[model samples]
Target: MDVLPDRAARAEFPVGERQLIMKKLIINHDRLKEARDAFARFHFPVVGGVADSGSISLVMGDSRTGKTFGAKSYLGGFPQRPGERGMIYPALLVEMPASGGYRAILENLADAMSIAHTLRMNNSVLTNNILRGLEFHEVELLIFDEVQDVCDIKNPRLASDFKRLMRKILNLEKASIVCIGLPETYGLLSSDKQLVGRGGLQYAFLHPYSWDSDEERKSFRLLCDQFDEGMPFLNKSSLGATATAERLHWVSQGIIGLLKNFLFIAGSLAINDGSIHVDTTHLAQAYDWIKPPQTSFNPFRDDWSKKPDTVVTTAPLTTHDPFAKRKRSAHAQ
Candidate 1:
């Protein structure tokens, strides 16, 4: 694909309309599609009375590399439907609990499947309930996001127990398992001789684009082009132009999630200011808005040839705390 396309007419839309457009935009690049395809390869229809061994696939990447987004996008394609027994979910993606353990994993699974269980229920009972749910739902694919937590367990016994549970689930052949997490998650199946020997483990790595090679640079630019085309603005952003692409790459470090956020903010700034298309100034202000005040190196304003010493960092957007905080009485002191 061409790195740059011809500019189009300007969009004349209200600020709210423009913001809504940006919110609904979904850009699917080559790498994201490849990850989705890998998931599809492992998913198979359930054949009655046949015990088909479930395959395990790993999708590993650093944070903000679109690992979870890609997996969830693929899962979204297969909507749940009414089946003879119950609701059949063709694919289900569950997040791994922050406090990782056998029971935590089971609880997360139960929550995803909407299976009710009490604190009094033991692990065996929970596992049985989960298995029954999987069978009744006829879920063909199971995805565990943030799976690195499961691999980070320090206790060997706990890890072994988790692995055994996974094996039990796979032996049932109700669904194929896809573990999505940081790169270290590859170790989840590396030491398991039975899983490895079965030749059912597959690995896919999602990485941010690096400007170290000609091919990599071209690919990154092409991705920029795709994102530019996907934007809702009527006028082309020329994001793939040499100067703009360099600035974008420097700002986002070629992470699609960051790039998407950056562009949305920049585009919003442009639309809010009654501008036809995004400019470097809008991007500069957007950078200031999204990042910490101490982050002074604005890629939009700086020379793209001279990369910054530090990477751009985003500030936390919300102050709301989900966990309970300890409170002290006024008279305690």
Candidate 2:
């Protein structure tokens, strides 16, 4: 009995797309440079400002714009030049508890430094551990992720308390602290009034292509083209898949998160097929699976975006802060 026309069907076709996601590049390249430049500007000894004057940048953009990676990668670039020390000691990357206070945040910082946090629910010990970790690493900057999970701005009492503690411990005199979170996080940051008064280079806003110029679109596409698995290689994009590749930017909405996932899954499927080249059919499957190639993060509604608009009215994290931080939410989703 004749089986079928296609025989070696189950082979890897788009291996590159399936693995090397575009999101990683955004984090490692596009965003990293942003942080470095911002920090460099503020690192000035006499930038001249207020109590805490340095360039404490806030990258609040649409969700999936690679905010986490953008800020986190800043950790790896150290020694910001000789004699130019970073704020944090050894680099403490903390994730605030969804419903937590100073204690929970300190605990997370300790964990990031790989130090044993003997908090056992003890705030003092937790604080001491973090201090030691920071001192050990001579850390210059403290990075907190999912800061939005910590609170809402409407509550005056909570907001006041949060501000007091942050100033006393984190901001105290002059420590460059970087907060990583969705655009809403910036709202929470500004609600403190005092926090916002310090001044920050606000970004992290995903444009959603609302007013993108042609050059901007072309540049981003060019970057993605470098890694487009449907294409041939760096110099030659979509050598065989050129026709289908044209729509890639439109489908991915220039959002790294969307593009990465689209390529990864579809690329994997193609790779599994072991085809030497991808066809429009593969792009369709990828597009369908990707759902939103051009998805944007509407920070106001939820889940994720830009300069951070008006602060949302909610109480800041107090004694009642919970363990349900952003990671927990991410896990839940």
Candidate 3:
């Protein structure tokens, strides 16, 4: 496999500044791979033996649990082996804007299809162009990431506009739509009766493994083992060790995003400090860099014999409306 040159490397940066861009991590664990496969196998239903008609499939998870990765994998899986199929685009992924509305969504779709003149056109014209472009490009799956952004807007009509847009796309194009976001995204989709009726499948990525369940703990340990194997330090740190794993779970509060950040910080700190091993001390420094809420409980304290109180309170991942105050004020009058 030929490794592509980093585009960032070509850009001019100060000597020391370039080092910060080089340390990037892409974790390809088994679980993520499985989700990708399942997403790929998803077939649009043939109603009354007619093909090309599809439904919406949603992939939901807490923040940073690989929702985008899974969607990207499915979108990137087209033509299977390279050159087998010529210019076949099986999936198209678009991100919903932070203050999403009908026009913004149409513009995004038009941009993804590489259709110009969309900016000058009206909504009806743009819709036709998008439909034509999707058909021309042979797009079977359409994905909208950060879909919760629509719901986060102060304008209640924005959500309904998105729902209407999605329903129209499904009816006209007969292509399946895959929306990826947090639990709130599911709520947004489920609110629409028409969207839910058309075979809406909810695939949720759960929170980090919990000690409350033996199966979840075992699964988490397996994940830790994979990370341990991948750790580049010369000294092998048994991340899967009972005590170490527990500490990690507590500090990370079972979120994969935090866990990844924790490891990255730990590795960078260890390398900078001239340490060949990544131990509790390195992780403690990593926590400081990460700024997780629990600063008092350092996992790598000198008292190695006892476990520290590192329990973290979990919070919902939804972004609230910025104009919520204005709406409340209006209602008060």
Model 1 C-alpha lDDT per residue in residues 150-265, reported as the tens digit of each score = 66656667667767777777878777788887777777667787665543577888887876677877888898887777555666778888778867776666778778888898
What are the RMSDs of all candidates, in order? 9.1, 11.5, 8.1
* TM-score (C-alpha, index-matched) for candidate 1: 0.81
Best by TM-score: 1
Better of 1 and 2 by TM-score: 1
* All candidates: TM-score: 0.81, 0.64, 0.78
Please write out the lDDT profile of model 2 over residues 1-333, one tens digit for every residue: 112112123122244533443224332334445555544444433465432333344655555566565555555555323224333344446677865565666666676666676535576666656555555555556666676656556545545554554554454334556666666666677656666555544434533321145555555655455445323222222512432333554444455565566665555555566555454566666655433233332222222223123222111222234221221011011
- Mark the 10 consecutive residues where model 1 has the least summed lDDT: 324-333
Q: Per-residue lDDT of 175-261 in model 3, one digit per residue for the tens?
A: 778787787777777877788877656455534456656676777676776566555555557888877776677656565666776
Whole-model lDDT per candidate: 0.71, 0.48, 0.64
Cα-based lDDT at residue 232, candidate 3: 52
Error of 3 at 268 (Å): 0.5
TM-score of 3: 0.78
Summing lDDT over every window of 10 consecutive residues in candidate 2, give the lowest-scoring window.
Answer: 324-333
Better of 2 and 3 by lDDT: 3
- Model 2 regions lying over 4 Å from their true place: 1-32, 39-55, 79-90, 99-102, 119-121, 128-136, 153-162, 199-211, 229-246, 292-333
